[model samples]
Target: MSSHSKSLGEFDLIERFFKTGANSLRTTADSAIALGIGDDCALIRPPADEEIAITSDMLVEGRHFFAGADPELLGRKALAVNLSDLAAMGAKPLGFTLAIALPMVDKIWLEAFSKGLFAASYDYSCPLIGGDTTAGPLTISITAFGSSPTGKAIRRSGAKAGDDIWVSGTVGDARLALAALRHELNLPNADLQNIAHRMHQPTPRIELGIQLRGIASAALDVSDGLLGDLRHILKQSQVDAEIQLNQLPKSITLQKQGIGIQNQFAASGGDDYELCFTAPSTQREKIHTISKILNLPLTLIGKILPKKDVEVRIHLLDASGIELSNSEAAPFLNSFDHFAS
Candidate 1:
């Protein structure tokens, strides 16, 4: 691949693989895109009366994923993580721009990666508008564009003292897969395969986010971990929260693990891209109905609390309603930090 890469100029690489793949994924949003690839820049017009929500995510080899991970899944995840950011804001995906640095232009890898990337673009109705290609370490960065009704995007600062905290789908499976892959834990091969997709191809809760508009008071995607990410809302809203450790939703595979494993991973699993949100207690019935409508489980795991004159932002509780001490909950309190050593 490296030898052949010498013959593949950057322009030729983009035109043959990326641009062609992107053109095939164009959607109705094309009308809003005044100019796409083959130009200095891509121009897109956000829908009238809507505000654009933009987000960018970058993945680097050996940092975000293994050095020789599947290119197809990596491609899907590159855009999916960015789309999850849009979903966090209750926005509809419009388009995306990808900036990728390749160690070498491998045709086979490019074909598989482009297939997965464009597949996700079509699935979310987000076409590839424009981007740049370069030569460097294997890294992919995607900036996604989305739109939401003016002033209606859900935010982390909207949680009130009495709001009910909820989470969409389940958590912990991604981290479980990681632990097994790293040999930190052992699992049946079948079970590992079952949960591996949660780590590789996360589903962006875009539809649920759109439906949460005006319903959810505050929301964010659980990328960094459930307990750690929830602190963002508490800090922003100047509120506190109490969550039942046992109430966190987990997949059947994850449930097979011990309680300690469940609590640690479910509370602090970093890559689960599910939606954790807050809504009024009065809207519990409504949220339940929406869960049924979407065929997604909406679990009520906690409640918001009025801010007390204390440093703690949230408390973890056992089934007996006893709050765990800071030391007892210490392991689950920290979120994933990219630069932490």
Candidate 2:
């Protein structure tokens, strides 16, 4: 621990590092926060007819990330994951609170971490309201707030049979990076570098979520593997889904792998912070236009099906769109389970 950081108390640390102009997002009178840091409690007043959307996430050392990782990237990812939840609900970011636990105060690490945190805040226009700091094992917990028009927040329960399933951006790159890091797969330096960004600094599709409010029937952020998160929608909507393996989008880095590897990672690899949504076939043109406008690839990968006999299920299909037998899909059906050892 640095002598400078050791000399400072928690309050002093906050005043010197966090309670600065750089972290302030309330530059205008119309900002979401009525009162920011320094108060006992931050004040937020959403616009009329809008509903507040709140989400929280926690990142623990050794589990979520490796120890001695880049502080800047860790700070950014800590908040980005929560924002992804808001994006899934089609909400506009209002502000957020950060509660962090640190084993010891390191000035240099704190500086870099705060820089990355505020950078993401400014980029997303979400201000830091208030939170708590404590001494413990290194952990980052963030609670993000957002707003959407009343009755307009998209949800997993709204997906209907016949809705086309869509996924934004690419998948599998983050898992591929993890595989390389774990030595399960061998990758060149360039490939490792390319996929590492996807694992570290994932972009939350806030704009895409806002635009999809009326058009998409149901949506979610793909945090756990695509298939796993999609199951949430299926359970909520009481429906089944059929997806084509070939339609899952992939980055150039992930595409370099073999077909089995590509399929495995795309189906069950976690940490792909992309939006997975369902829309009616009639809105295909509008979705395509939105994709062009955003310059983000939105691929139709599947369709929701009626739950005839089963409670909820998924049909895995091949490149030719033929449904795979139980034997063929056994490998791809499971996803990352935190409790599964």
Q: Which candidate has the top score in lDDT? A: 1
Estimate, for each residue in 89-141, the C-alpha lDDT of model 2 and write its tens digit.
Answer: 99999988888778888889898888888888887888887777767799899
User: lDDT of all predictions, in order shown?
Assistant: 0.89, 0.87
Tell me the TM-score of model 1. 0.95
Q: Positional deviation of 194 in candidate 1, in angstroms?
A: 1.2
In candidate 2, stretches whose alpha carbon ends up further than 4 angstroms from where it belongs are 1-11, 21-23, 26-30, 338-341
TM-scores for all predictions? 0.95, 0.94
